[model samples]
Target chain A: MEIKILGTGCPNCKTLENRVRRVVTQNNIDARIIKVEDIMDIMSYNIMATPGLVVNEKVMTKGRVPSEREIHELLTL
Target chain B: MFLNPTKNREKAGIRKYSALWTGILVAIILIVVFVRFDLFERLENGVNWFVFGLLNLPADSHLASALEFFLYDSIKILFLVFVIVFLMGIVNSYFPVDRVKNYLSRNKLYGFEYLMASLFGTVTPFCSCSSVPLFIGFVSGGIPLGVTFSFLITSPLVNEVAIGLFVGLFGLKTTLIYVISGVLLGTVSGIILQTLKLEKYLSPWVKDILSKAQHEQEVFQLEKQSFKERLPVIWQEAAKIIKGILPYVLIGIAIGGLMHGYIPQGFFEKYIGKDNPFAVPIAVILAVPMYSNASGILPVIQVLVSKGIPLGTAIAFMMGVVGLSFPEAMLLKKIMSWKLIAIFFGTVSLCIIISGYLFNFIL
Candidate 1:
């Protein structure tokens, strides 16, 4: 599984990134986590709001950081 | 070294000085008359038409009903904007900058703190202009630039006026979504800016201020006054801000009230209703350059929503108007270069448009 955290480099984006990392590690999932910090790259995803979560190339959540359990469910799906 | 000329020279110098002062006074009076009679009143009256005419519509006219819808739904929005600004002024005065700095600086790269600040900012309802001074204080006090941005972005976007308008017009569910979205955006944007190592992009002056945190000590050194002393200061600040804003408020209300009483029904429906694909973008573009307080724009938004305009599009438009007005951009020019201003506008505009689509898709 591949999870992408999209943001420029703000505190919330860092939080989301850390939370996702924790969730992935705890689940023992073989997932690749990537952070996109470039404005153009983030914008290319058509995400105006930052700290977005992209799971398997589809935007799953944005603007807010979802809970670890929520991420687990999203990954499972 | 010259001949004996003291007495006559003194009298002549005094007379020349008096003549010069009289000439300056006459010029000033003439200029005041010209401005008052020939320019100021005319401009004021002309601008008033834009504000009032939008509200007053002929009964049979196509726009009358649409205008009426807005007028009726904007009262809560007006109340919220006023309350938020007032409260923020109080809070700003109450909490000294040192305290905020100490709290933020205690932790290094704590994401949770940023989120909290963003949430607090959203609830406060300060406009971008009013928030700038606070932002300057925060960043200069050694708080992370990203954390400051979190507060700055959310303050205007999630203001009380927007919330009140949402609650009154769309009810609790929509209001909740709006609040949640605002917090998320603020937090995420803050974190992203942090990651990019963009703090270096800030002006050298800002860096200099932050480096010399010792200077801020003087700000806190003032004799700590009791709550009683503080209360008067708070009241004075509030009164000053209110006095400054009252005219805009009245102007906004007058237009909004008139719109409520007039406007034709279904007029806006045919043009930018929910089904229109271009409605979202068009609304975004139109709202970007416009300037108005929350109270001023609420009536217009209410009418659009009543005419079946999509909720997301209307929200995007409102955000554009309130969060990224032309006036704000112009004012920011004093603090930031034109390039930064353009980037700020572009980034926020894109954010709003995407948020609009996201809401439309989800809700």
Candidate 2:
């Protein structure tokens, strides 16, 4: 699975990235997590707020960090 | 189809409606008690007694007054912060950024759009570091540059945290003036910048995105949850915000306490007093490099006002500190040219100064 975390390196973005990583590791999910900090790259995702989560290139969430269970569910799904 | 998974928690039933009504009922009761019982005055008196009578501090001493000021202001300010943030959290969960962005993009309110944008900025909670992505998002999403500027300018200046502190520190009249002035600053600055046609000054990367952004924009699917389901998240967010700002509030109040008690009445008056014609502009100029959120600065502003600084000058300084700062400028540098950044800062600083002078004149 491919996951992209969209942000401009804000605190929320960092927390979201860490949460995603932990969920991936603990659940032993096969996924690559990429942090997209570039303005152009983040804008393309159409998210007005930081800490967006993109699962398999589909924008699953933007503007908030989901809980670990939510991340695990997204990963499993 | 993937979005539906997130909506699994949106339970539907009479229970949800009942929860909503219960919340409203509780809010009404709190407001009734807060208003009818004279809670604020009683609290002030209680603090006064605690400091003077209970602690056995001399009534005439500066230390007693300072201690009283700190305890009263901190409690009142912290309580106000929690209530305001919690309420805003619920409001935010319902009107999420996605919905707000969509609304702004799709609507054409003529000149009112700028005001609308500014209002959005006032309510939406995002860290200052998120400005770049938010700027890019609004711009790329076909929102006009002026409207985007309105949001960018007002987002930091007028927020719930600031509002709460302002109300606690300066009471209703001054707080109202501050809020109205903040919104006007954003709106007026936006209109002025919009007239300049600064589109060409955006970063080349933004230009590239603009060139290619005309395609059918994807509708970001978001889960719709009832307030009941959103309550837990909202509570957490409110708590998090209160925790984050608690330190700044206490420190600000502590400093304000010292200034309140010990600083002679004419101390600040001798320097930035109302008699000084240049005080407002000087305050604004001096505040440019100092970065602080409203929570940290408002308490200091209270003391400055008490010390005989014109209300206008101190408020201008507060706006300057809260609204325009080097770090925010650095963040904006990501999406704007040096020329654009300078213009943005220049315009905001000018507005803040004018506001300071106006405030001094009126008050």
Specify the highest-lDDT model's number: 2
Q: How do all models score by TM-score?
A: 0.55, 0.89
What level of docking quality does candidate 1 show? incorrect
For model 1, the stretches where C-alpha displacement exceeds 4 angstroms are A1-77, B1-98, B123-133, B161-172, B210-265, B331-337
Interface quality of candidate 1 as DockQ: 0.01
Candidate 1: tens digits of C-alpha lDDT, residues B1-363: 565699766765665455445435654675577557864345445544544575554655535543443344333344444444445544554343434544565555546867977876764535443344455566655677778777777877886556655655566698788888777777877776656555454456545655764323332332244434454544454455555555655565456445545655566777776677777777889988886566556655665565566788878887777766776665455445676666666666777788888877776
lDDT of each: 0.63, 0.83
Q: In DockQ terms, which candidate is top?
A: 2
Candidate 1: give the TM-score of chain A.
0.95
* Worst lDDT 10-window in candidate 2 chain B: B213-222
Deviation from native of the Cα of residue B36 in model 2, angstroms: 1.1
Docking class of 2: medium
Off by over 4 Å in 2: B1-29, B212-222
lDDT by residue for model 2 (A34-66), tens:
999887788777777777899888999877778
Q: In candidate 2, what are the lDDT values of residues B7-66, reduced to their tens digit? A: 544544444556556666766787799999999899999998898889999989999999
lDDT for residue B265 in candidate 1, whole number 0-100: 58
Candidate 1 achieves a global lDDT of 0.63
lDDT of 1 by residue, A1-77 (tens): 88999876655678789998998888888999999875446645644345789998999976556667878898888
